[model samples]
Target: MIRTVLSLIPAEYARLTPRFLAAVVAQAICQAIAYVLLVPVLKSLFGDDQAAAWAWVAPMLVAVVGVLVLGYLQSLLGLRIGVGMQADLQTRLGDQLNTLPLGWFEGRSAAALSHVVVDDVREVQGLVAYLLAKVIAGVVVPLGVAVGMLFVDWRIAVTMFVAAPVLFAVNSIAGRLYSWSDRRIHDAAVESDTRVVEFAQAQPVLRAFGAVGARNRALDAALTGQRSAIVRMVFTAVPSLFVFTILVQAAFLVLAYVAVERVTHGPLSAAAAVALVAVGSRFIEPLTQAAQLGTTLRSGAAAVDRIAGLLAEPALPESTTPVNPGAATVGFDTVSFGYETGKPVLEDISFTVPAGTTTAIVGPSGSGKSTLLRLVARYHDVTRGRIEVGGADVREQPTVTLLGQLALVSQQVYLFNRSVIENIRVGRPDATDEEVRRAAAAARVDEIAERLPDGWDTVVGEGGASLSGGERQRISIARALLKDAPVVLLDEATSALDPHSEAVVVRGVHQLSRGKTVLVVAHRLATIAHADQILFLDGGRILERGTHDELLTAGGRYADFWNERSRAAGWRLEPAPVG
Candidate 1:
């Protein structure tokens, strides 16, 4: 288990090795000195002429005071070092997580990562302080006691040496069982976390479907399972304690009998015999504590394994080449991709949008319209072929550099729990208040802002739940306008808006799209009727490419789609007015 934990230590912590080793050495020396001083004092207290040993009192008192002072200093230093180490661990973990690709987050739960970051890191400090300290104390203190016992009688020392191993063997067996139970407890904890997150995220849906009671019961079951596992782990330790107590008491009883016999029948002094029993009893305390701490260390090792597993997940590969795209043209060159292998969502597709023009992508559901936009943004790497932005292959470019050139507004907008101005500032983190207001005005969000109690400073609720759908969409568009990147990608950006809101957002889009490369994916053909060019996609293949008037004249997929959408919007084909 120690080997396993050692493997998990981050390379950045190598600098701390020397200090940690020094701390262990200091604790060992302190424990040994404490036990050595304790033995002579015990003998002196029981001397036949106690009044004559008054000189020993002063030295013993000084030794006790010194031990306490050293112990307190050690604790303070250990706590300081532990906290420093934990801070470093958290920083490293956070950095690693940030560097990882978005796909890594797709398969893992936020709650599980939260546990690793917050709970598991805390356990490391507890393990270092309690387990490492106790183990050092156990070794040095017991050795000191044994040396003291040898002066009294080698027989008692040998008896203790034999009994210690027997007790250890019993504890070792129990520790194995405890380790297994601990694993189950950890698993249950992760399950409980997952359930809580699921319940929280699905609360609205569950309530809408009248499944809240079922969700509550499921969460209850998860908690119950976690509790039961903890109970089993707690009970597993009881047997180890029971065995340790029996073995330790038996060893002391045997040592006491032999010590009395030696004092009465041989040259051993009575004071020495009593001190030998005192030393023997003292050994049991550290030994038992060490056994308990050993279990704690094992449990901590398990938590470390879990945390390390998360950190070990492969992060997004870093790009070495700098991307300096002179033009904002976006293109896909025979790209193929799938969330799962062998079932391509997009296959051998190719397209291009020239700089400073609007290119609309229209497709039926599941035709990979949004996926194509994601490809252009490089959110996920293609399984085959390459996508280029500004005439440079996206894979060769740093993700930051690639994404910096683009602004994205999707069907769903995620707003932070912050003021409207603060949320917009996420796009251009250094934008002035006036610039923010200008962007909001351009997106038509300022219309609503004027009536808000605090205007742009009004706090949006979590996920912007307090805002209307159109308000949120406009806020999202305002963020994009604030970014003012050379390229813009909009995926059904106005889907959630009412007709009036749609017009407001459409006007904003028109103003925002000027002199920028814009790629829009929309199911509503009317939204893209004015687009400079439209590409009609079906089954992940482009079937037609032209303007709305040209595609309508062609009488193909685009024409049929345009007609269907127009009819849905209550437009009647009035025989073209005999033109």
Candidate 2:
């Protein structure tokens, strides 16, 4: 455990910097000097025959008071420095999280990351401040007292010196045991966090399925693991305390025997022997402090490792090229993509949506229609070929620049717990209140807002659970309308709506897509029927492509899918009327 803790000290020191170390060292030295100087005056006070003893007593009191004042000031300085360091670490961690690839977030548990960033980081601050101060004071003060002991009597000093090796060996073994248990405890904490998040997220489903008892059992299991780990940690620490107490008692016995022998031989004064006993009794204070600090240091080192791992996650390469989206034309040039190796999601997909036109992609489930739309927004890079906007590869353009040219309204709308107007403003932060209201009206969100408590200022619960699905979709559309990007990507924008609501949202979508390049993953036949171009995808390949009328005439995958959907919706399949 000492090895792990010692490894973290250099990192903490480096992070805190030389100035903080200097302050801590200066404080420790001052405290040690105060103790050494007070010993003599304290010894003088013991004498029965006083020759103006108040003179020495007053000076000693003043010096002790001065040391206390300096120590308080140093503590305040260390606290400020620690808070500042923690703030810097949090900022860096937040920035690193944003820069990491989306897939990194997919693989990790959000609750575990949350615990490390919040709870673990806070622990580090306490550990760094308390353990560092204790270690410094423990080493300096103990060494000063040992030197003072030698001045009183070399025999007592020799006993302390001889006992040092035994103390080191005991502490070293205890430290290793503490470290092993501490790591287990930290892991259990992370697991508990993961289980809590999972449980909360699954509560609705669990309740729907009447599986609350099952979930409770799972939670109990996680808590049981955490309790067991903590119990093991206590077992490791309790034995160390026993050993430390025994060692301190043995040291006192040796000092007492040596003092008696010296007094008998007339080599030590009686007052000096009494002072040596007083100092020897307090000698274990530093060693005990150091032992407790070892545990804190070990826990802090584990936290540092977790934070470092988060920061080390891969980030997308920075782009230097500026984007000039001349026409908002989106084109896929032989693009191939796979979420995993040897199992392609989209293979050799190629298509183009010209400026000021709507292009609909129709496919069965898992046919990669949404993936293609994601590529246009550059959510994930292509594995092969290129995705270009306005005649330039997206990979060559800055991500901010690429994103600025497009607005996305996904099937899954994620709303923050904020006022409706503020959520809309996320897409265009500088938009005026009037502008936001206008967008909301245009998206037909006003229909739902009229029933809301405060209209546009009404707070939507997390994920917009306060509103119905169709209402959430309208708010998402309002956000996109507010951004007013030249290119719009809609993934089942109207899928959440009832027929009447769908009509309202579809009209709004039509208005929003005016004079802009729109690429839609079409779930409704009505949405695709109006598209100037339609791409029929099957088995990760573009099986057919043409205008809606041309594809219907071709009577291939598009016709088959249209017929199947038309039958499912109970729509009559009739011949096309003369135009």
Candidate 3:
């Protein structure tokens, strides 16, 4: 536990380390002095010099003042350190996450990441601010108090030591048991939270299906599991705590017995015996604190380990000598990738989108069309072979530089909870308002902007929920148009638009993609009918490739798809026969 905390303390806080150490020692010493002064006071009370009692009173008061001043400083410094660590951890995590591949994030739940950064980090901060001070003082105070008692009477010190082994043994076992239970409870709680969040997010669909309870049964089960785990932990831990309490009382009883026996054996005066018994509570108090504090520190260690795991996850390695592509040309040479090993989504795939030409990839659902576009965008590295842009292998180019050369517009567009103008400006942050407005006009975003009360400044609610699908689609196209990258990856970019908006978007796309390398994943055969080349894929391999006219004349899969789609376009609901 101590090792975990020391590793978490950043190097910049090195100076604060000694300051806290001093505070802990000062606080502990003051407490020991306050308790030790009881001996002198008791001696004064029974001795002939009754007026000398006033001398012991002043020093006891001084010790009390010292404890207060040091304790306050310790808390203030500890809180500042805690807050600083929290800020640092958040910043570091964010910076690292930005550099990670999209594939890494795809395998993890958003709820799990949020819980780790926001919830678990806060709990760890609390451990440092509250539990740490108690821990330091708890360890130091007992040792200080024990040394003072030894000077008063070695026999009494020996008696206190008799209970030391028993007290420590019990505390050690309890701490281990509590830490095990804490980790289990922590995991259960996280699972419960993840289930509730996922369930709530899908509530609209669940309600429409009238399967709210049935669909969310897993959430119900997760919560019930958490409750059962917690109840079981309580039943097991309470008995261990009872044993700890019993041992503490036994130590106190043993100290009192030894003190009376010493007086009977003439090893000490009556005054000395009374002082030994007077400060008996202070001797065992620190050990009791340690027993309680151990649990919290151990939990903090677990949180630290979790955060460290995130930081340690390998980021996509960048090229040391990065190269710039000579042109916008893109090539996939025998590329293969999969979410899971041995389950290749695209295998031995090879293709090229020549500069200043359009290449359309058509495939059935789950046929790796979208996955191919994502690879060209370098969201994930090719697992089996190489991908090149401008005759240069993508792996040789720096990720940031590579990203700057391509603009992707997918069917599902994402907009921040910001102004309509700002959402469009995401394509190029440095673009002027006038430039953004020009792009918006080209993509027909201005049509929607005119309907809004605030035009460009209108706040698009979270995920642009306030806007219609066509309006949002236009805005996304406007952003892509503003980017004006050399290579454009259009993944059914106009799928959400109405017929009128779709025509306007097609014109804008033509303008944006003119004289650029274009790789399009087109579901509708009509949209890519005039593509420079078309690759018809099925079962992760390109089955046929040619111009639309050639493919139709070939009377293969493309022709079959075209005939089916054409028939699907003309189908309508038929009137049921009266029976």
Query: Residue by residue across 450-552, what tens digits does model 3's lDDT show?
Result: 8899988999986787887678877888998898889998987665567787777778777777888989998665667979999998888999998999999
Off by over 4 Å in 2: 1-19, 33-66, 107-110, 128-131, 143-208, 211-225, 235-274, 293-297, 334-350, 362-369, 381-385, 493-498, 528-567, 571-579
Query: What's the CA RMSD of model 1 in angstroms?
Result: 5.7
Predicted structure 1, TM vs. truth: 0.80
lDDT of 2 by residue, 88-178 (tens): 6677788888776554575567677787778777876676565666766776666666676676667677787787667767877876787
Report residue 198 deviation for candidate 2 (angstroms).
6.7
Q: Which candidate gets the maximum TM-score versus the true structure? A: 3
Give the Cα lDDT of each candidate. 0.78, 0.77, 0.82
441 Cα displacement, candidate 2 (Å): 1.7
Determine which window of 10 residues in candidate 1 has minimal summed lDDT: 1-10
Minimal lDDT window, size 10, model 2: 1-10
Which portions of model 3 miss their true places by more than 4 Å? 33-69, 153-206, 211-233, 236-239, 264-274, 291-299, 320-322, 493-511, 538-540, 549-563
lDDT of 1 by residue, 85-155 (tens): 57877887899898776655766766778878888888876765446666667766667666656655688
Identify the superior model by lDDT, candidate 2 or candidate 3: 3
- How well does candidate 2 match the true structure, expressed as C-alpha RMSD? 6.2
All candidates: TM-score: 0.80, 0.79, 0.86
* Candidate 2 local lDDT, residue 117: 79
How far residue 276's Cα lies from its native spot in candidate 2, in Å, is: 3.7
Best by lDDT: 3
